[model samples]
Target: MPEEIIDLNSIVSGRQPINSSETPKEVTFDRVHSILYGNSSTKLIYDNAQKYFTKKFDQTYPHTSLQRDLFISIIQKVHPSLKVQFVVEIGSFTGNSASIMGKVLKESYPGSFLLCIDTWLGDLAMWINKAVWEHLSVSEDGRPTVYYQFLTNIIKQNLTTMVLPASMTSIIGARFLQTYRFYPQVIYLDSAHEQGETLIELSLYWNLLRPGGILFGDDWGWSSVRCDLKKFSYMKNLTIEQAGNTWILKKPVN
Candidate 1:
């Protein structure tokens, strides 16, 4: 009897191929950075951020230690390569981290970009945390949102070209990309910190990540994150690499 060989390319496609550059590469960072800080001053965006926070929320700009550490850890993990990089960020809040990643893609990995997937609705944790809630904006009629602020941040830094936005749930976004056969070199998950949701997201995005690509994110200190990740790691038979509060998982190169 002859063995049947599978022809994967025979699968149905939803859309025509969209022209894009090749796969991913490495990164870097500096002061007054990531992207689109405008042309006036190096500190223009920072100043604007502070002013915006003070005027709107009556608080300081919210750059935290977790973000700083995440940036550094990502820089360390993604090596310098000439290949074009594709990144998908599942939870973009106010676009600070996305902008930082945009800069990394723009400067270090040329022709690269980051796509942000989020509903812009506050997660359960964010809804419960007062400090996080302070960052959310509401329409006069009463629709709470942080999406506009995220868009503004991306535009303010001129990162629109490098940082694309998709206002949707992570699962839906993942399935959409799967239809296009879109595979990112890096996938960062930071949505709802629930065990079930985290596990499901990790599995969904893991399939969309190209081999050797890294899936990492912050909130490693969250019990839900740690527990779900442990389950995910065990299931995938992949070791977890930790740097500060950031957790990393690399898809096998083969």
Candidate 2:
């Protein structure tokens, strides 16, 4: 009997061909690269931003360094040539992801822009979480300052020019885009995680995606997210690919 050995480097480079019976289970280099060095660049920006925000405003951000990197990777994959004009993010919590995307778009696609749609009112969970309320600034009338922090973060990143802030709920924002006939190359959904809301968002914004565009989201492991994505894929007859914790569905080109 001959010994069957797997060449690690060959697998990583996709150079060596595998026999049918010896086919590897997964051959996604993006996932592998993410596991190895995904945080290399984004982490620095996140850490610096975190320190600055904490020192200046005594505040902390919501999204993690991993999420920031993943978002960038998705944007890169969608616009490999850096020719995208518009990218939309459904939830722009604290503006971390939006700032990152804004920087990437500005550098890669000079005229590209990011449209972030969020009410900035911490979700139900955040509203109930005392920790969230403690870090938030209050207005003269006593309303928690969510949108202000988001704006401050964007400004800190110097992304005001590339990132457009749309202060509104997901549904209203999506409808506005639809009514305005705005089509984006990439649509990222990270807002409501509930199954029903997630499904609605998937449906509503899916249409706003240009043909051959990408509609991706985070929290793929969440039961609601996973189930809804599968159902949506089935309904649309599209295939879903998992990149890190994100699930992506590329619209068919007509």
Candidate 3:
């Protein structure tokens, strides 16, 4: 059989047809705030980062503005008082999410830093299964230049100082953090969504989060992601919460 063709533009434009019968509710700032804070009275930060990403990069990120607000809220809740904060993001594709979070950190906590970890080469699954190879950046030698794009996006947003890049796999990045004894206040896992890989990441990065910190991931609706998160939460004796397409696991304050 011929290879199945996935429309990159359709997915980016949110025009992709749903393959499942169940339709998730639309994610809004109020909905996300309710789930994360249990109340909607708290105002969320409104930034131009999303619009900047859309206009400059022309890529559709899976994360939304509401989700980004939730992230900032969690960060503020965990580390109230504007101290230096450290955030780790396992997947920093095109720097959209990173840009949003970085902008928040820069404005709220002047000395805060964000560590964006990614292979920076397009995922093999996207290349082989989704046939999105052509959408990725290319070098003179025909290699993917995604890392360059990520760097450029951050620099363009004037976030190079706040958002640092780790051009490596998630496992390697986690190991480097461990070796350095670097504990982050918030860790976002949006890398591998396979059940086993997600489990490994949770196990590996869970201890790296400080007390009262948070560990969250995107793609909560995926079977592999949800199943593994449920199992992981059960094993860790933590309650999992949903905000839009994101699943959050907060470390206890003990």
Candidate 4:
């Protein structure tokens, strides 16, 4: 196996990144409300999200994948097992949502683990939208290297035991799971919002999801995302549901 191939379990056994002793940086909000708010369409969506985050998430910043209550409720009400033991989270930016999820699974679904895969690099929109890029954790070398901070967040939450970090592309992460014969009961897609990329990711990860598993993601407000999900749902004959900014699709149990 190559160095990039992550041993899913071993990653949580210990964090192998540099400066292990360094204090974890506390994540702050984009209080200025920057993150692509310049675009009229996205601004409208962001403002809408701002309202929900303020009400439900305690006035937290709107840059993360949230809705803790919604996620747990779906598992409890919809999923047959009423528990999620395995989760694969694509695009964990600084582990904000993963921390919430890790904590939830730890308390509600004991013995569960979340494999968080990411490139630790901001998406293209971030680079194009300077305000968005400003929020990322950049290395001294000027690279958007948020991976270490992601580990720190996991450690701070005491989730290293249940939150496995895999720093790589979504495709490689899927391959890693396949190599281990790993199958996830839940797959979270938050990586790319581009229609083409989103479709590819949805199709690629669908194979890794167990029957009756849930495939969900954020950014439903983005036209591209909505279009891609609708197209994918039509192609697969899967029914997609949405509540707030999150969307979900369940694989039929044959």
lDDT of each: 0.67, 0.66, 0.67, 0.67
Q: Model 3 over residues 48-115: C-alpha lDDT tens digits?
A: 23432232443454433335578766676574432436788998877878888888888877667787
**Which of 1 and 2 is ahead in TM-score?**
1
lDDT (10s digit) by residue, model 4, range 3-37:
23422234323324333456422111121112213
The regions of model 4 sitting more than 4 angstroms off are 1-61, 81-83
Q: Clash pairs of candidate 2?
A: none
Model 2 weakest 10-residue run by lDDT: 1-10
Q: Per-residue alpha-carbon lDDT of model 1 for 1-254, expressed as tens digits?
A: 11123222232234443333434223222211333233334544434534433323222337332364466456556544414467889988777678777876677766677878888886775677777776767566666657667766776677755676677799888866765566777888878778878877887888777776788887889999999898878766889998777889977867
Residue pairs clashing, model 1:
24-85, 36-157, 36-158, 37-157
**lDDT minimum window of 10 residues, candidate 3:** 1-10
For candidate 2, give the lDDT of residue 101.
73
Residue 109, candidate 1: Cα error in Å is 1.2
Report the error of model 1 at residue 201, Å.
0.4
Model 4 lDDT, full chain set: 0.67
Q: Model 2, 81-106: lDDT tens per residue? A: 42467788888776666776777777
How many clashing pairs does model 3 include? 0
Scanning candidate 1 in windows of ten residues, the lowest lDDT window is 1-10
Off by over 4 Å in 1: 1-84
Any runs in candidate 2 off by more than 4 Å, and if so which?
A: 1-59, 65-69, 79-82, 133-142
- Residue 57, candidate 4: C-alpha displacement in angstroms: 18
- Extract clashing residue pairs from model 4: none
lDDT of 2: 0.66
